[model samples]
Target: MESPDRTVHVAYDPYVIPGGRTIHGRADGLNGEWSVHLGRQTSVEIVAGLTDGLTRPRSAHAPNV
Candidate 1:
């Protein structure tokens, strides 16, 4: 189990565009493809997906719809 203050990482395949445009699409509804154990006294619920870095559109990266 990880602490609430711990960092949570979410993996996703991003769309890419020419010239390195990057965008992070919104997380899938519910995002319930996986689960995590918070702790003995805590439970896991409503897990949201996310990207590794800022979810901004980077022309040099890829286009995320």
Candidate 2:
């Protein structure tokens, strides 16, 4: 089992805007596809929505959500 204290990463496609780079839409309800040895909850879900990032749209360099 994985510890809740540990954080997991999620990624999605990025889009270009008139101002800068950002996600075209919300990345919510996608955590269900994540798996980090979360034994009891192999398919745990998040009730919140993810914000759009300009620089790092992918999970590689995400700052604060």
In each prediction, how many residue pairs overlap at the backbone (N, C-alpha, C within less than 3 A)?
8, 0
Residue-by-residue lDDT tens digits, candidate 2, 8-54: 34333233222221223223465433321122222223211332222
What TM-score should be assigned to candidate 2?
A: 0.15
Off by over 4 Å in 2: 1-35, 46-56, 59-61
What are the clashing pairs of model 2?
none
Q: Give per-residue CA lDDT, model 1, range 1-65, as digits (tens).
A: 22233333332222332222122233456533333333222212323222323332366766554
**Worst lDDT window (10 residues) for model 1?**
16-25
User: What are the runs in model 1 whose C-alpha is more than 4 Å off?
Assistant: 1-32, 40-65
RMSD of candidate 2 to the truth, in angstroms, is 16.8
Best by TM-score: 2
Q: Worst lDDT window (10 residues) for model 2?
A: 35-44
Error of 2 at 35 (Å): 7.8
Task: Tell me, by lDDT, which candidate is best.
Answer: 1
